[model samples]
Target: MAIYMDEIVKQMLQLSCKLEHTVLNSDSEPEEWVLLLDERQYLMKQLDEGILAGEVLSDHQKMLLAQIHGIDQRLQPIMLERKQGVEKKLREIQRSKTAVDAYHEAGPSAYGAFFDSKK
Candidate 1:
């Protein structure tokens, strides 16, 4: 079936906006990156299917598809950067958790009584 590329275009645009926000200072969970990856893959598959079907395209859709392609090209590096940010944040959290575990393992005296030694 012929699908309007605008659907994919809007999806790509949203992804670009997300990448922008993710690159900025904010703590994003790993799931957020996974969502973005899924979106990208879905849009790519839609584009491929539309092309392979040789669907009749409207002028607006053609123009929008071109714009979407342009945005995708510009946003590739930003997506990579955001993916790195996500990975780095996940590692930091894991490392922090490990340190806390080690501190607690040192015994109740080190915790200043906030944690009961008996428990």
Candidate 2:
């Protein structure tokens, strides 16, 4: 039983590192990053569930958990950056939507009206 629990903890630690890398600075498309971030959350949920299921921890298991804690600490900034990135994206979308709405309300400006009619 303890061995099984130890194995689960090791898996969680690996997943934690995977998640940290996924959230690290990247030049990938936003949608790709979004998918990665979503998967990260799923991984984290699984880790939490596994941790909760373990009825008891041996000293070895505790050491593994300490490693997980270190990984989590390393992930903190990346997670916060992900959150801030999401907020910034939402704000940009809002600004773009407002510009589109205002353009419609004002109708075409002289520049658009002139170019829109012909060729």
Best by lDDT: 1
> What are the root-mean-square deviations of the candidates from the true structure over C-alphas?
6.0, 5.7
lDDT of 1 by residue, 1-119 (tens): 54467677667767856754654434765477667768878887887888787866678767766775776677577667777877899999999999788767756663366454343
Give the alpha-carbon lDDT of every model: 0.70, 0.67
Model 2 lDDT, full chain set: 0.67
lDDT of 2 by residue, 21-106 (tens): 66564753446546655664665575566668865777987887788788778867766776799899999999999967765775
Give the runs in model 2 whose Cα sits over 4 Å from its true position: 28-54, 108-111, 114-119
Q: Itemize residue pairs with steric clashes in candidate 1.
A: none
Can you list the residue pairs that collide in candidate 2? none
| Residue 73 displacement in candidate 1 (angstroms) | 1.3
Error of 1 at 29 (Å): 8.7
